[model samples]
Target: MNPQFEELQKRMNHIGNLNNYLEDLLAKIPGNLLSGKQQAKLMDVLLDDSDLTSLLEGLKDPRPPRFVLVGRTGVGKSSLINAMSGRYLAEVSDVEIGTEEARRFTYESDGQVYFEVIDTRDIGESEAFTKDADAEAELAAVVKAFRPDAILFLQKATERAHSDIDVESAKKMMLSAGYGLPMVGIITHVDELNPSRIKDPADYPPGKLALMEDKKGQLRRIFKEQKVPVDAIIPVSSYIEWSQDPDDLSEVERGELTIGFDGRYGIEELLDFLEQSIDIRAAIHLGMTIRIHKISERIALRFIKVFSTLAATVALSPIIATDIAVLLSLQTVLLMIIAYLSGRDLAFKTARELLVSLGGIGATGFTLRMIAQQGSKFANLILPGAGSAISASIASGGTYAIGKAAVAYYLKGVPEEELNKVVKNARDEFDRGLE
Candidate 1:
């Protein structure tokens, strides 16, 4: 395991998982929009203890975003993964195993894994394998072995050899994935397009852009003609020439979007597409992706958003202390997760102590939220439509305040004196936006 995320797991070990309180709070919260079925679905997610442990294990080992690569041999599969990883995770090998196992290729650096993919065996390459191997049944077995979060059909930006065979094979694989699965068409090696001198994608000339658009259009047209479902068509150049020494990288190169080679483009966009198209629970693992230390901050930022939104949306119109307790419990869990993400001890005591440090003007937000709730109650006597909106506004703002304050403290390490200002500013800013 990478020293960074391995350390994260060590820190997480200190925290206890008490999902019961969260489940109870969620069950009690009045859902204005959620039906009984949705509530039950949410509870079922929390009830499974093993899933929670597996999530943390995924971060530590870095095995998630299980993608199924659907294409013939070559098309820069190794380079695509390596480019996405910003490391030499996959070695391009010339020798073929002559096997059709659909093996899982795991990419790990410094012992921490980032992701895994089902590298499917090339079909129709050998007439003997295609005619006699029962490729369809093999693919079904693959589906059981490695359930993919996304499926990608790959083609070289410069070559079109066996495109028909690749597309047909992709259609057959869809049976294994089941219908409605997100399938993306990838046009790789865009740097090899016309005007090969244009290496950096940032400086892609008009000729290169036209060629890329042309390829994307062709891919899209083919998929449509075949009646094969594809969610997105992306043309990407996944080649990145990194320095042998990672620490020797420049400031610009160190940035997430910037790569060592100029021709690298469309990868970040593809990753964004995967995050959006993948399962919501799977997407959560994305927080720990890329830079290990900063992964925590990303996770913490998302936590604040998720907890605040859940608290606000589920809050009852009456906005009683029960509503506050719901918010508090969710916020507390949010803090615990945030703390764990920051590589600190993940415990209720840690959150409680930090919260105590924030001072209790009803824990810096509750009292103000209650005051607003009381006013909204009176407003309900007159115009309930306006009062309901006001209640939502206040609940959202209050929880957001607590969350932001904790983020500043835990993630940004903002000083104690500054936390109150953050709380007040966040609450005021959110409330104003709602207004």
Candidate 2:
């Protein structure tokens, strides 16, 4: 018991150190600290460094096809990576404990075409084992380390999209980290269909197999609702003994793809997509991905403002009644100082990453005001005078905690509501373009 407790403590300490380092590193970045033209100059340099042109030059295989297999735990993400590599590059199993960190496997055919596949473990794990924010950070690290050419979102076709959990989980991770990178879906485990199967619609459930045109429409409709656009959805089976008659009229192709010296699912289309569609050498996707990260960064920055504002209101309680106008000015001045102090440890690179979105500043300011007002309301509920500092501090702390949680919740939840909004906006803009 003591050993277990000690191990848990060690893990907590490690995470704490990592978080502290990130905060400190992000503080020194001039793009996050400076304002006006100075910030612009620093941003230009930072973006140039992070952009496609700079990173692509360093790639060992300039135009090598690289793909990251991203999906929920137990969804066979590692298996897909290993299958594609034609070797045991990534550990595979029915159980979900193998991948706890990012696994990178590089394959080269001849000297020209190189394929690097990255596997991340933060997707689709239980709440007890993973947090949404931690998963986002881990994926961001994966993106920063190896910006893949394309993403293969592997989902088990045999498994129904029973709940919104899987789609929502992937949405937050990708949008928060990978952003605008192109993605294709491989609905695996389709080989599980019975050998004698023909045209019994009841054999395959509605959502499981998008066999017919209407089924494809249904699948696309939901995928659209989830804000996940797939370039293609290829159904597959990775079963060991799975086989199909080559001459059969089954819409699902067989013997076209093989895995582990045996026939398996979705291998052909997956390979063809990578070979034909993905431009493994381009940098344009990196710039677009940065924009997606900016949306989350802006939301994070807003929560930070709320925290600092509440802190100031608590610290300056005594002078509030003396002059409301003067106190408000003092609060503003303090907020600026707090922003600097909090951001002091940020790195030049990390800050630029956080400030890519133009909307972050205004959103942060608005969120801070909301937090401050909530804190004031709570303070009014407390009896004025005597132990005011103690009461106000508690109120302020509660408000800050709730405010941050709310922002996190919105980032996870609002995208579902905003999916239709995004599609509508795209169509409206397209019509304007046609005009």
lDDT of each: 0.65, 0.43
How high is the lDDT of residue 39 in model 2? Answer: 31
Root-mean-square deviation of candidate 1: 8.0
Listed per candidate, the RMSD to the true structure in angstroms reads: 8.0, 19.1
Estimate TM-scores for all models.
0.69, 0.38
Q: For model 2, where is the 10-residue window of minimal lDDT?
A: 283-292
On residues 291-408, what C-alpha lDDT tens digit does candidate 1 reach at each position? Answer: 4555556545555665566655545445443344444555666666676556564455567566555544663456655566646766666765566566666666666777788788
List pairs with backbone clashes in candidate 1. 1-111, 2-112, 62-113, 200-262
